[model samples]
Target: MKKQLATALAALVMAPAMSATSVDLGYKAYTSDTKSDNGGAYDQPFVKLTHFNKADWGTLLAYVKLENPGEVKDAQHGKDGKLTVKSLLIVDKQIGDTSYNFWGQNFLVSNRTVMEDNLYLGVTTNRKYGALFINAGVGLNYSAAHFDPTGASFDGISGYAAVINARYPFSAMGLKHSLSVNYEGQIDRDEDHMSTLGYDSYGHQIITTLKTSMTESFYTKLHMTHFDSWGAAPNDGIEYGVAVGFTF
Candidate 1:
């Protein structure tokens, strides 16, 4: 069946990403106001956490991933918060089974942050979709977001994004700034999302992160994407915001 094939292919593709010795976890919270409701999950904001790590096995390696996520909203308040959990894994091996270097990817899915179950792809050893996605051994970061204003089906509002980035410690100033240029698109919806005549609305975003600083063990700060929806204001209203994060 198609499902089984997809699962098998996903496992093969994820083999390389899980071959590392360390892992990192990140969380973020953001809020924005958009115009209408597309009946889809748009500006339906929430909190989320994602993690990835590497392992070593003389000739083969195991790459693991996990994410715990949550979200709150401004549109349709009662149906506001949706929570979900997911697990991801992959492996890696030398290209010719001779050398010690290798590469791979990961497959992750969620019910809360996803609709009808979707598969997301990621790379390891700094490779993305066959592209050289590394600035300094860090990694590439990207996300797709949408906000719909019209209370329609799957047609009215949507957003998409792609960004490749890296970061390192700056001991001198106790600060680290990640920089990237990302492209994003926002699409509007109609009453029937899967319909042929579904031309509702859309917009684009090009953004950059200016700086990030760690003031203490309990706090860190950063800024990103001063986005202005292009053409027709795809979803609602938002350019960028200041972000502050803390951990125990």
Candidate 2:
């Protein structure tokens, strides 16, 4: 999965280089404390890549997160070097303040083959009110998940998904800050609800992120997310993380 994601990111980076729009790369450290050992006090180091186009199409983002990088020696699997990779691609057609888009996202976790992927058709609109700038979007999505952690093949579990995202930004003291919220709900196919052990295979998640700019190209952010499950989705807990980012 990591190799595949790296290839995809390379393609995205090269596709628009002739135009040479804009690119940013940054490193972040994330930590969380939760009741579950899976989500407990763990440190994650991640690298992020983002590309923006001068043309009409939107942005492409790719990132990889490694849990407990280089700390515990000789250990393996979930405790030592768990890997997570994510990628997103957005293509948009804009008409004034509104933009219609088709987007796709892929997520994978290592030491296992649990993967989630989704595609969405959405519209986004931006507006300004007083000193605040607001951006919002909604999408209809189709999602699929595979949970063969041991490499055994299984039937793909499919679902219908809905997504919403909103952001509000304002400036103060010559610095910019923004609050962003995102929500996703996936409802599994009725037949697949009980496919993953005895648990329902669908999930709903909400995340809020607050970012404050330190400089024109550097920022600090805090993210909080809550996962709700109808039956027994994997991400059924709360997580909080802080990150620092830079753009050039």
Candidate 3:
């Protein structure tokens, strides 16, 4: 499954590059105070490579981050030298001349350093209302994970998943800006899988971002994230950060 997803992602990256409508690549740095249920807090700085691509067929967004780059050894959370990758692909088809469209979306997050991977596939509806655009769908969720020290592993179809995303763009203080929100939820989860993975049947995450362009090629963003019963430890936490980047 991971191999198949990787292949599809590669195709999206390469095929879209030939005639991409727009592409942006930049560096991002942020700090998060994310904590696990066992009272382990991961308040570390992270650096990432961010990429965004848009074309007639779809849009692709990816972030690859290295946790605690400055630390020589693992911190309290043992995340040093860890690499995390999160990506999303959306393919759309317009619904006649209306403001609605049909979309096929794929979201994947891989934390190879921790031996975890999550994949979600959804058929969504996208609609535009003036400057606000929204996309939502329900789909399937697959998860695989391995625990360290204990050496336990799990892999299977975990449950049903729902995804929602919204964006609104405007001008403020003479700068172009946008506000976007994203949500992902795991529902109807397999009880055994949830228990074995140390997560909940209804894990979810909500992220909000306020972004503004400093110039035509430069931008900044403020982000806030809230999550519960998600990730590796059935944890809940809130994180906030800022990022600056440039676009070409």
Candidate 4:
């Protein structure tokens, strides 16, 4: 599955007029309060790949979190992390100051993990005001669960959510920078499971990101995310990560 996804993304990026296509590869480290049984923390490293405007189609993005290559396993399904793939399509329709977007994303957690797969379909619109850009959208989400070998099995669940985002551009430390905030709320159902399977009761999430342009084709970002939920596994913790990317 991972190979297939990589191949498809490469094909799209290498299509005609490929020089116009841009790709960024970055490294990210995430720290969370969640811990494993052996008192080891759930901090992990990830490799992120992003492709923009391939064949005038859309942007393709993917990331994979990895466990230490030679780390010892504490359980059958060790603390291996997650993989996520996102495809964003621009509608190319500009009404006054707003532009439209349609997007889809797939989330795949480690094998035997609680959250098996999450699929999303959404439409969004954005507008700019001075140095600020705002976005709003609605989306449908479907989440599947992993079967616990020694616990109760779970089935797939589906729901819908609303999203809003705000971004401000500024200059700091003699570098071009931007600050963005995003919020997603589950209005139709309070148990959408956008983040996790067993943690399905999460109704909302908030994310804040600070990014700086290091060069014409390079940049860096620092981000923090929080999940709100009241489920069996309450994922009400904060996750933070730092990343650096370069475009070609």
Worst 10 residues of 1 by lDDT: 135-144
- Model 4, residue pairs in steric clash: none
> In model 3, how large is the Cα lDDT of residue 58?
51
Q: Which candidate, 2 or 4, would have the higher TM-score against the true structure? A: 2
In model 4, how large is the Cα lDDT of residue 146?
51
Query: What does candidate 1's lDDT look like per residue over 1-248, in tens digits?
Result: 99999997766656644532433334333333433323222333223333334433312323332322345443244455444443433333434433323332233333433421112222223333333233211122222222233333232222222223343333345565544454434344223432321333343455554435454333333334333433212233343444444432
Candidate 4, residues 18-83: lDDT per residue as tens digits? 433344333333333433221222444444544434244433444444343223234224644333
- Give the Cα lDDT of each candidate: 0.35, 0.54, 0.65, 0.55
Q: Write the per-residue lDDT of candidate 2 for residues 1-248, one digit (tens) a residue.
A: 99999998777556663242222232332223233423322445555555546333444444454443444322224555444555565554455444444445544443333555556565655456674545455555544555664343234535555666677787888888998888777666435533542335556778898888888777888887776652112435666677777666
- The better-scoring model by TM-score among 1 and 4 is 4
lDDT over C-alpha atoms for residue 145 of model 1: 22
Q: How large is the C-alpha RMSD of every model relative to the true structure?
A: 10.3, 7.9, 6.5, 7.7
Task: Give TM per candidate.
Answer: 0.38, 0.64, 0.74, 0.63
Q: What lDDT does model 2 reach?
A: 0.54
Per-residue C-alpha lDDT of model 3 across residues 84-163, encoded as one tens digit per residue:
45555555544565444455555554553345566666566777899999988777777777766556677888888888
- The lDDT, on a scale of 0 to 1, for candidate 4 is 0.55
